[model samples]
Target: MRYDFLIIGSGITGTMIARELSKYDAKTIVLEKENDAANHATSANSAIIHSGYDPDPGSLKAKLNVEGNLLYDVLEKELDIPLYNNGAFMVAHDKDEEGLLQRYYERAKTNGVPGVEILDQQQARALEKNLADDVTKVLNLPSTKVTYPWEVAIAALENAVDNGVSFAKNKQVVSITADNEGYTVKTEDGTTYHTRYVINAAGAYTEKIAKMIEKKVPYHITPRKGEYMILDRRVAGFIQRTLYPTPDEKGKGILMVPQYHGNILIGPNSEHQASLDDVSTSKGGLKIVKEGALKLAKNIPFHKNIRTFSGVRASSSHKDFYIKESLEHSGFIHVAGIDSPGLTAAPAIAKYVVDTIIRPKETLIDNKTFNPCRKAITLYDDMSAEEKSVAFQSDARYGNLVCKCERVTEGDIVRHIHRSVNADSVKAVKKRSRAGAGLCQGGYCEHQVIKILAREFGKTPLEINYFSDQSNILKNETKVKK
Candidate 1:
């Protein structure tokens, strides 16, 4: 079928693009390779909304970081997702490193950031007491923040759909043929997409897609992997704010981050890779994460370590966000080379692409009836006693506590499934409903979650995911005579 726009890759970049198009009168569709949005690097990111502090001067990262940071307050309200502007602190360990931190603060000011401040060690200690007494200085980026990445991605896609954009899951595009009218995209499932525009937002494989075109874009992409460790919320008391250490030539060094989930996250050591599939965690990476956490976190206990995961960044050799379109083919655009503050830049980048690349003069009508607000997840604890009693009576599943670690009930799991929750992978469910992400880490709830998935998704017990490898929980099935 024909669509005005075909966005390949349902990561934050693609999702945001879809949202931008939804504001106009355009037929848009986002094609995701996985079962749902954000199953790739989007689901596994460190969830830091950068303050436009890093990146070299005069780079896209610097420009878009400022623009993207400005939209958080409005976007959070529209999407109904949790956006925590807890701010950040780049703590200097010694007197010698203090000057470097100040330089970063200056960069933020140069970029038109309003609240960037320089604090002495004593002032920093007043803000966060857990800092080591020997600390030299700290940079307070008050606009720094964190958010649930998956929530933002999903909400954007949903809002785009509400404003008229279709989402095709398991639609992995393999090849694109640009023609006089548009491009014909052939997916792995033999589905064909004939669209006026092609957006190559495919995160890791963006370079591969570029090579598919005859006039391939001049670009280079390298995978930079970052691994992280999540500390239990109980350990959050040890953290006064996001902690940081000195940086080297490679990238941002390991540090402690307070995630939106009310837990402390650390590590994410940057490792460059030649291929996208090379994303994996190693004991060496974990060692850096833990040791660095201890050094940066003056009071966080190591016993709080609960989980470890890694995400790969599509680093470009040019150190800038790459957005290119074919001079011969107007509709074919490459939103590649998106790294670092790409998450923060996503919304702004979407608007920029629509204005500069698409230039849909005909479809410039603003959506008058667009419902920007989405319903937040219902929390049982938030309801009053009478409300809980009524809710439990309406659906007994609401009272059935299935996941003890997170106080998740059967009703919560059902809502996730009915909402088209992405559960093809265990991580998908964890991101969607916090099912297996609690303290027990699925040790007590794995079987229960599998059973629910089997019943909801119409899969056999063995068909449900058991681990990251997509292994089934049920070892065997029995056939009995009636």
Candidate 2:
């Protein structure tokens, strides 16, 4: 197939870039190696919307993060994604930590961060009553927020498709060769796609993608694996705002994020890994996470942790995010070095690429009729007294609960499965609908979702998958018994 542009990843950056480019009249195609968007780093992180307080002054991360934070209000409304400005509290342990925080406060001031201030122990405690008493000092970033990283990516990518962008899932780009006017990319599935431009948004493999074009991309991605713990909805209101630790040379300390739903997330142990694919949480890493969580709230009850998992960050080999045009190659752009603030910086990055890269092109034409709004299903929590009556009267599936833990309705799961690519995997469905993200994890609805998959895709429940290519489910009725 021919395309004006070919994107090399399905992570958030690729998805957002596709969404950005779709505002024009270009024919684009996004290739995802995985069955779903945000399967790697996008969905793996803690979902923190950073407030541009940590990166070095005037860096790409700083500029983009600051701009991205401001863009969320309109972006969320236009995209129909949920966002919570749960504010972050960076607590200090002692005078030494307080001294370090002073530097960060100054840096934030220099970066023009709004709502950056120091709060006494009493003030911090009042902000979040569950904070440990020893938190004598705190830096309050009132602009800090939380969002569903996976949902944003999914919506953006599908929105791009709605605007004429094509998607080719399971089409892993194995090699790239430059041609007379453009590039020819070959996938593992033996199909070839030709495009004039290529964008490297592969999270951990961004460097590898550049190597395909024989350009020596300088950044090295170190995998920083972060293990997270999800508490039950009953513990959602334990803290009124997100909590963080003071920034230092060791990197930003652990964080407590309040999800948009009535639940809490504790986690993201930052440990460097040797392999890019080493996203598995180690025993020691999780122990550190538990200890960190207890430090914030001693009553967090690690026993209530129904989910423990990890995601690898494409940690910058250098200092800041690298989003620049390749001097060595034309039509090749680098979007590597996306770490903690990448999600917050994504929208700004999209704008930057558009202005610096796309707008200058002679062929690029603006569609005056472009509509940024997307029609997403926001009825999960939007069902008020009147809306519930109207919905339930129209469909019985809305009343049938499939995931009791997350309050996911049968209708929600069915729609998510139909909308999501390769709707056979539990992991795929979760990324789309938050199906198993609640207290019981998948213990309550994994079987039910598999049955739904069986009915939708004409497969037996036994053949259903925990995730793509990971099926080991036991057949409900044994053939030997029959």
Candidate 3:
């Protein structure tokens, strides 16, 4: 299908951009290589809405992060997503770190981040009782928040789709050629799409997409891996807000984030690598994460840890967001090198790209039928007793428990399967609903999820994949007793 704009990724940047563009009267399509949105870096991250205090002053990361942080309050109501603005603290354990906190406070003040203050030991301890004894000072950032990274991207993509934006999944852009009129993008499946504008938001592979135009792009992307550990919900209250160590050149130091879903997250030491797809958590990297996090919050319950994983950020050599219409290519826009505060900077970035970059070149009328509100799925676990009864009365599937650990019912799974961004794999369902993300880690509910997927998609259990197409769980069938 021909489109006015073709976005080459389905992460936060691309999906948010698509949602913003959908407000205009134009045909937009988002091409995602994965089976679902947020299958890559967006799925795994610290999930913190940064307060815009960490990035260097006057950089794109700083400007967009502060602006994007302010957009979430309205976005939460519009999209019906979870967001916890409990605030954040950067603790200092020594004189050097205390000086670092002072610098950070000044930087936040200069950047216009709201409610930033420097707290002494007594004040910091009053807010976070688990602060290490050696911590001398703390930088309080009241605007900091926590959110599910995948949920934001998926919700934005779904809202865009609801507002007339089309999404083509599993369509990997392999090549692009610019003609006199526009650009022609070819996918790995041999399908070609013609568009007036090509937005390069492909996380990790963004540089490669830019090079496809003329075989050379200005910047290079270094995939930096960050390892993390998720503790059980019992330890979720170990800290009242996100805790951080003093900043460094690499990125925000390993942090302790209290997830909005009543869980705890920690770690994410930066390890730069050349491989774009290396999300493997190493033994040493995770060790560094635990050691670093313990320094900020000494009372962490390490034995309560349930899951360990990693995500790769697209770090560019330029060290700032590489967002501009390619000087070499006319219609191509590069939103690359978006790391650290990229998630927090996404909304502002979308608006900036649309308002400052695209609108100046092309005139776009407002789409009159554009709707911003999206109804979220009915979660059985979060409802009251009366609400549960009403839900059960409406559907018998809600009465049947599919995942005991998370209290996920069959109705929840079925509802998520039929949405605009449906769950196609076991991992997709897990992300949509908390079916397989409980303490058991799908050990008890995986078979049920597989069966449900097979039934919903009209495919055999052998055809269903775990996450990717190549990772099919059920490979062969055995002879059953007749």
Candidate 4:
């Protein structure tokens, strides 16, 4: 089918861009290589709405970061997603680091990040009592927030789909040929897509996509790996807000962040990897995370560790977001190297691409039927007692709890499976409903989730996979009555 725009990758950047374009008279399609959105760096990162203090002043990252940070309030309301402005504390360990705090404060002021304050040790400890004794100063940023990155991507893409943008999953783009009309994108599955405009937001594979059009694209992507460890919800209130150490070249140092749902997360020591798909967490990396996190908050209960996972960032060699229409190809735009501040900069970048870049090139009109509101999945815990009784009466499956740790019901899993962007696998269900993401890590609810998925999709338990189709959980069928 011929489309006005084809977005490569279903990460936050691509999905957000698709959402922005859906507001106008454009036929857009988002092609995802994975089975679901945010399967790579989008789902696995620190999940923080940075207050735009870190990026160099006047860079694309800084401009978009601040603009996107301001949009979360409206986004959270419209998308019905969870976002907590729980604030942040950049702690200083000693006199030298205290100097760094002053420098960061100056940067924050220059970047137009509001409500930033330089606090001494007494003021810092007043906010977080568990801070290390050696911490002499702190940079208190009241605008820093936390969110589930994958959920945000899902909400945006789902809203876009609701507004008439088509979505295709597991379609890995192999090559693109520029034509007089536009570009013809060929996928690995022998299917071709014709589009008048192409936006390359393929996360780690963005540089590869750019090179697909121009052989010498003047930029490269390095997969910088960052490992993280999540503690159980029992450690939620231990450190109230996101806590950070002094800055370094790698990125934001180890942060002790509180998830919006009350879980505690730590680590993310920056380690650059040679491979784009290497998201495996190493033992040494976890150890370094533990040491680095404990240096900021000393009383964390390491025994409460629940899960460990890693993400590979799309670190650009250019050191800033590479967003611009290609000089080599007319209709091809590049949105690559969006790493650290990406999650926070996504919406603004999407708006910039659509309003500033594409609209001027083409005669596009507004899609009057566009609706920004998207209904979110209802969780058992978020409901009032009266609402719960009414909901359970309407759908008896709501009474059947699938994930006891997270209070996820069977109805929740079933709803996710049948949503706009259906949650097809165990991991997708976990991302959508938090079924297998608790302390047990699917040890208790995995089979139940697989059973629900199998029933919903008309498959057997053995046919269900974890994340990818190749990673099947059940190898073969056991004893079954005929």
List TM-scores for all candidates, in order: 0.94, 0.94, 0.98, 0.98
What is candidate 3's TM-score against the reference?
0.98
lDDT of 1 by residue, 1-482 (tens): 68888999999999999988888777889988776787667777778788888877787788888889888778988888888888888878776788888788788788877788889877888888787666778888888888998889988987888788899887878889987788999898899889988889998888888777746566788899989888887765566567777677878788788887778888788889876866678999889777776666565666777888898888887668888676556778889888878888898889889887777534577767767666667756557899889878988898878778778888877776665334555556677778778888988877777878878778877877643434656677778576
lDDT for 355 (candidate 2): 82
lDDT of each: 0.80, 0.80, 0.90, 0.90
lDDT tens per residue, model 2, 167-221: 8876789999889878899998899999888888898888878888855777878
Q: Of the pair 1 and 3, which is ahead by TM-score? A: 3
Stretches of candidate 4 exceeding 4 Å from the true structure? 480-482
Clash totals, every prediction: 1, 0, 0, 0
Ranking by lDDT: 4, 3, 2, 1
Clashing pairs in 3: none
- What's the lDDT for residue 390 in model 1? 87
Please report how far candidate 1 places residue 175 from its true position, in Å: 0.6
Would you list the clashing residue pairs of candidate 2? none
lDDT of 3 by residue, 1-482 (tens): 57899999999999999999999999999998888899888888899999988888999888999999999888999998889988999999889998999899999998889999999999999989998888899999999999988889999999999999999988989999997678999999999999989999998999989989955688899899999999987786789899999978767889999998888999889988989988888789989999998788876898888999999999998999999998888889999998878888898999999999999999999999999989888788788999988988998898778888888989899899889988889999999898988899899998899998999999999999888766788888898577
For model 2, the run of ten residues with the poorest summed lDDT: 467-476
lDDT at residue 139 of model 2 (Cα atoms)? 86
